[model samples]
Target: MMEADILIENCSEIHTLKGPDRPRRGDEMQDTSKIKNGALAVKGESILAVGSDKEIKRDVEAEKIIDASGKTVIPGFVDPHTHLIYSGSREDELAMKIQGKTYMEILEEGGGILRTVRATRKASKQRLLEESKARMDRMLAHGTTTAEAKSGYGLDKKNEIKCLEVIDELDKSHDLDLIPTYLGAHSLPPEFERSEDYIDYCIEDVLPEIADKDLAEYCDVFCEKGVFDVEESRRLLKKAKQFGLKARVHADEIENIGCSKMAAELDAISAEHLVKTDEEDIIMMAESGTIGILLPGTPFMLMEEKYAPARQMIENGMAIALATDLNPNCWTESMQMVITLACLQMKMTPSEALTAATFNSARALDRPDIGSLEKGKKADFLVLDIPNIDHLPYRFGVNLVEKVYKRGEKV
Candidate 1:
């Protein structure tokens, strides 16, 4: 018999997210690939096996066994696009937002990404790590085991490098597996007159430094109306690609500006915040097989009436994922919260949202190991208090995670 460290039996259901090990699209997103009366075995940091409760109990001898009773088990969430290394809060912007001031209007009034940028620039590396660790703690408590953390709040070379360094520290020390992204071109620094000049500075100075130091796995830019336009985004992403970093784009959060199309042409791994992306943008992205990471929390927090055309994207055969967009403006630690917004605002069903939150989000990060609970995959998963999948999204605004297990150990 196979020996195992732990065996969890009699789960009401288990969504293994069985996959061909790639992002799911169209009707594929609707398949949870679940097992009824399921059970799973964990041996060290990997899943040894998963099957019917009878099958697991018959085939394996485990040191510990837990009866999950009526709970639902699924892979821990993988948040692919989050500004996770910044220091500071933007609670003051709440009043401005409620006053009918737009996100761009708040920025023009010196409040938004740039506002956090200034604070992040001044924070010590230790302080950043401490603050970020707290956030990671909350993320883990809410069932996120792996996440992509971007260093965009520090817009300059030095401060940007500092933020990446802190991300590195947290990756090693914290339970969360952080994939670092250098988003130096997130905004135009005040020192430069033109956005083009700031982009040049980033490509010339910041890009090379980040690449040489091997600080980040991907490069991201805010590609929108008021930020880096298509051409500017193209220049930096191309250079970052040359420097061995993969591409991710914050495109069409407010306006299209052809950013999603540009991202598809460059074969960006994912284009995020597509609230304004139209059919052409959707078609091109689908053709390129670029994943659209829908951050529903963004529009929800921005108080905008429009959200990403998630149903259209899914219907058009584009792979869609969901994330918290965890930043100063939309400060949320729970992927559960993100899933709720995705289902309610973007019109994705709970099953599709769960798949987007787990497997598709992992594929977006290009990590194949953690999303599904397949045999030999990392044992990062959650045991939720809910009995079935519907309860996950149906019960919102509260933590549904009853237990979180990362790499086979409960946290």
Candidate 2:
């Protein structure tokens, strides 16, 4: 018999989400690769075997065993986009939006990203770490074991470095695996007069320092109409590549400005908030294999009727992922809530939403280690209180995650 470190047996259902090495697209997203009466063994941090209860019990011996009877197990959610390291709340801005103000209108009035930038810049590293740790704890409780966190709230060189450093510290100390991204081009700081000059400063002064410190794995830019245009975004992302950082973009949230095409041209790992992306750009993104990261929460919070064309993206053979877009503005950390919004607002099926949040989100981060419950993958999964996976989205506004495990250990 093979000796194992841990074993979970008699799970009512297991959505392994296992399939081709690439991200799932079109009809493939609906197929969850489920196992009935499932059981799995973990050896150290990796999954040893996954099969029927009888199959695993007969072949494996473990020091620890968890009887997951009547519970469903699935891969822990991978949230591909979040701005969880910021300081303070935007409830005041929320109130402003309620009184008939647009996001850009508020930004122009000095009350959007810059508002949080001011607070985050003034925050000490310990203060930032503490706040971020609390947010991550909430995310973990909701079954997010891994997430991609960007440092865009700090628009300048000093505070940007500080933000990334805090993210690194959090990653080392917390069980939640936090992937850091440098988003110095999130918006123009008060110091820079022109957007082009700000981009120049990021490429020349900020990015090299981040790269030297190995502070971030990815470099992201906000590629909207008023933020950074297509050409400016392209230049920043190209320079990011030169620093050995993977590129991601916040594109086409409010307008179709050819940013998605820029993402395809630059081969960005993913393009986020495609609520206003054009069909032509969507096709280019699909063909170039750039993952579409849809944030339904953004529109939901902003009170916008239009959401990302997620159903169309799926129909067009695009690999789609879902995220919370968890910032002070959006103010959410629950993947379950995001999944619910994806189903109700974006018209994705329950299975498709789960797949997007788990397997496809992992693909967005270029992480092959934690997306699925399969041999050679990290044993990070959620044991839900429900009997089946669909209940997660069906029973919206509830926390269904009974327990979370990271690398074969309960957390």
How close is each model in CA RMSD to the real structure? 1.0, 1.2
Per-residue C-alpha lDDT of model 2 across residues 1-411, encoded as one tens digit per residue: 999998889999999998999999999999999988999899988899998889999999999999999999999999999998999887988898899988779878878878999999999999999999999999999999999999999999999999999999999999999999999999889998999999999999999999999999999999988779999999999999999999999999989899988998888999999999878888999999999999999999989899999988998899999999999989888999999999999999999999999999999999988799999899999999988888888899889999999988889
- Candidate 1 residues 1-411, lDDT tens each? 999999999999999999666789999999989999999999999999999999989999999999999999999999998999888898989988898888778888888777888899889998998899999999999999999999988888889999999999899998889999998888888888899999999999889889999999999999988778999999999999999999999999878799999999999999999999999999999999899999999888878799999999999999999999999888999999999888888889999999999999999999999899999999999999988999977899999999999999999
TM-score of each: 0.98, 0.98
Look at candidate 1 and give me any clashing residue pairs. Answer: none
**Cα miss at 18, model 2 (Å)?**
1.2
Q: Which is the leading candidate under TM-score? A: 1
What is candidate 2's TM-score against the reference?
Answer: 0.98
